[model samples]
Target: MRKDWCEARKNDPTPTQMYYAKNGVITPEMEYVAKVEMLKPEYIRQLVAEGKLIIPANINHINQIPMAIGRAVKCKINANIGSSALASDINEEIEKLKVCLKYGADTVMDLSTGGDLDEIRRAIIANSTVPIGTVPIYQIIHDIKDLDNLTPQIMLECIEKQAKQGVSYFTIHAGFLLKFMPLVAKRKMGIVSRGGSLMASWMMKHHKENPFYEAFDEICDICAKYDASLSLGDSLRPGCLHDASDEAQMSELAVLGELTKRAWEKNVQVMVEGPGHVPFNQIEFNMKEEQRLCHDAPFYILGPLPTDIGAGYDHITSAIGGTMAAFHGASMLCYVTPKEHLGLPNAKDVRDGIISHKIAAHAADVALGRVGAIERDHAMSDARYKFDWNKQFELALDPDKARELHDESLPQDVFKEAEFCSMCGPKFCAYKISQEIAKIECNDYPKEKK
Candidate 1:
């Protein structure tokens, strides 16, 4: 370690939090995360040191509010916000970020492959208080028309640009090795990841190993310099329910597991990304297997939709699988929007996706009884039982929507506190009817001997 890096370097250039934690140095990020997770600083530091948790705050991302993802803390949700070649703009992407964060998305990834990619990332990072993640290969291939030109050097350059620009983590698909290609040959949907597919194609054309895999150490050096976490993208993730947990996906996971250890050696924080879609029954198996194979490094999984027919309602399918995955120990969920497989999402879709995953993560937390998870649910139930409309709205997952629907039918100012609403007139209200039944029992008490 350099002397200047310790004192004169604006911040402690301790390589990464994992480095400090492993060395028993509780960093500022760790202390901040301990407060948010309601855990002792030592506990947070220990788990992070052991590669069981990740605080994906890059040293350069000054505005980021530190977050914890692992088995010990509350499960986190990530929303994808970016512009495709067809729709490319900055303002709308920022709007989407606002919507996801408002609905409680723990992190956001900019998968922009169009427009001013650098500018889009800078704007999102500047406005975002939460840690931002990105895929470097998206931009490397975005500019180079032919896949032949996409080399290891270009990829590293892209990673350097984003890492220095306050990006907290990267989704590098170095796990997409050449041998896994033939395994996905028989799948229903082959290679769904844009970066993953581009990489596979590039490797096939050059008859060479994946640049990301070959140059992974160089990549680690860059990540360590900026304290960026590695999200080890699942390039071979299943695209449909039938393809879930297949040989190709498993092989990629094994590679990711190996890469996780390599990243740790470089003091780079690491997490393994999981499936695109999986059957309901296999979600638990996948989550557990990833934890076992990755040495319990934080597992971040996409919705892994349990059904393939759910086009417009993919958010529902995603939540179904996400619930089981999180319950089984997956630490982070990548939200799937209602428009999945149909079109890019708008702001409302972003809200819907995040709310759906938030429900899944919270339900899992409650099931695990982690810390203070159950209290919020109990509070909501109490509010409903007492007919506290405002309290009910406040306790709801989507408070604005809850308030709007309640006021739609019972618009009067007096109805705000009334025990009855438009759902049922006062005569049919269940709580009121129960009260009347009790009154009847009191009034009709058997008479004493006359």
Candidate 2:
């Protein structure tokens, strides 16, 4: 069934069906995703028309399954896993991928910076069932002998290579123009994104235009050919609350607005990647600006980590910001693990990051009134009210952990037939007292009335 859907997307009999989205037609991919999401086909089309939902299905990636991102559907979560130059291990990275999948990550990005980049990417692409994304600039930087040797052509070639390798989306830092460099140079963190910093350094050394900016249309053509979606990266996103929504970030955003229109003109799907570290108050403004300026392209964000502190607990900080961001209009969240600032995350960190973002996504979905979001919560509430421990555990996000925590303080043997557990103990249990009071009132109400 999946094969037929993918083949039809590539070779549908319709004459002008270049990309499924360009023809103003609904393809099998759309139908499949709509069914999975429990949304109507026309609603998916409407969101795609407004540039709110993005379905990243590359023609070459026959194994690629379709997923939607927009206001009308459940918010999606993405897990980023890859080896760095300082530390590289293929097995460990694969383990992280397993953890991401196990914890329900909607998508994964192969940000591998070391250990035969091509091999690592191929392995990840082969292993991933969900849509995969890549930052092409990372490979271009890793390949160059010296930073000065990098050129626009090298960067463009990297993008093409990855697209052919079946990357569903590409994070092109085309907004980091040479003109925006001076502004970043004057900032506290300079450039926070690795790709953004590399481009900035290269532009400064050569005094030339940003290759991606200068060749934006050509890049769009490549994306259209493969039906690969473009994730317009925020090269000037604020790295701290102090730098939130400044002129530099807004200037790059303006450029992205122009770029987004150009991509749509070529009939290519596009999304905008947002901030690094924004405060709680500014997340909504950032979301609104992306929607207004970029013509409502799906807004994918990285933590936007409300504050700079909480190194070991950045997951919580990110979840707080992520919920607000999604509620305000962001569609996809890039999970930020505990080791965000310190180092690469292990398997446990991946699970923690995905779970945190999953919670944020569910909360936002409920607020948005997406189907089934509230139903599960209501079911869990009913189970709790009935004192049904088994049902409660079954409905929990982390059932194993929930079961373990319940067993820790309340031994099953000691409280075999009791209606309450420890923490309040039997004497002080509120629910038990309430149950007793309800029975007494029921028995005395008739006699008192007589």
Candidate 3:
């Protein structure tokens, strides 16, 4: 007779570092994360012990490159890529995933609401070297054509299936309670989150509590079994600047805080998701509020876009807010592509979004003075002053774009090392001119040779 894992592993230690850390033991995951973060394994264990940091490596995500997310680690960014009801297939979604990972997305979410959700998720998860996250309610809605008929058990089952398949984190919207539904009536853009709106709708139709909230304990058990982290979704997050930091958002945040403690109680790693759109002046406040309310369980924010008018250039807007959010205390940024507010992002949009957030996260790391964060910026400036174009390209966030743009006007091999780029065309290059001026100053001070 074969024993089930529960019985067979009864005496064996859990793979979750939190489980191990709480017991004052450091597992290999802790050791690997220590090397990746450049901190000692013992220190990593301590942070995990305090619940100040999270390492979202599911035991089944065997190929994952382990990473830590919290105040202690370098700021991280997540890229969202999945098929919508209209565009993209499994291949296209996977292609986008490749672009996201290539461009430095710390994690990826398969937000597919169309065509074979399982197939798409499985393909992405099977090939993903980074953690894959998803909103399981989407699949439940897909399976149950009638929203009114959907049951709590169905939602939990679908999510458990994914968790078992190696989803490192989940965006469960347990915070969107029925009472909060009334507050959204006054908002400019009501219920912008897909998962948030769906949960609200189910609540309204059934006249009941949010199922995810009702089943929070069970969700914790499932996530813990697989060592998956919880990214408690902010379903009431503001969709526009005017709706930001409003009562609805804060109320849900309070609930998320409660859930965070509960998830921690079971040793399930938790990170709280935050705002949709917010003004620039208020971005820091949002970060602080979430940190305080959620007890700093690694806040992950979606742009908190400073302005609403950037439909075509939301990636840039996201970068601006993302930099500030991370600098203020956010641990992870969900990349908002140029196609935001318009349509599903394509391959280029994914690449563009990842690159933008990479800039934001790195800028935040530099601002926070994370070790070795400023070295690359210093190196780039030095390369420019010395006309080391090759080194400059290497130091660029999107090196391909940097190389391509520079080569557009100066395609010659000799220009690869030249002090001037097409922007200045040798004659007007500021760095080149500075070098010439320095030579003149040296000649004028030749008496130093005597």
Candidate 1: regions farther than 4 A off: 1-13, 435-450
Taking the tens digit of each residue's C-alpha lDDT, what string does model 1 give over 1-450? 122332333465556889889999887778888887788999999999998999898766777888998989999999999998999989999999999778888999999988999999999998888889999888888878678887778888889999889899999989998877788788888999988998888888888889999999999999988889999999889998788899998988989999999999988999999987888888889988898889999999998789899989999899999999999998999999999999999999999999999999999999998888989899998887678889999888899988889889887778878988887878889987876777786559878887
On lDDT, the stronger of 2 and 3 is: 3
**Candidates' C-alpha lDDT:** 0.88, 0.82, 0.87
Model 3 TM-score is 0.94
Clash counts for the predictions, in order? 0, 0, 0
Question: What lDDT is obtained when candidate 1 is compared to the true structure?
Answer: 0.88
Q: On residues 95-194, what C-alpha lDDT tens digit does candidate 2 reach at each position?
A: 8887877778988999998878888887777777788899988888788857787766777788889888888899988998887766876788777888
On a 0 to 1 TM-score scale, where does candidate 2 land against the true structure?
0.92
Per-residue lDDT for 1-450 in model 3, tens only? 112322433454455658879999876777878887778899999989778899898777777877889988999999998887787489999899899888889999998888998889889988888889888888888888778878878888998999888899999999999988789998989999988888888888889999999999999888888888999998989999999999999999999999999998899999999988999999988999988898978999998699999999999998999999999999999999999989889999999999999999999999999877899899998988888888888899899998899888888889997767777777898877777777785557648545
TM-score of each: 0.94, 0.92, 0.94
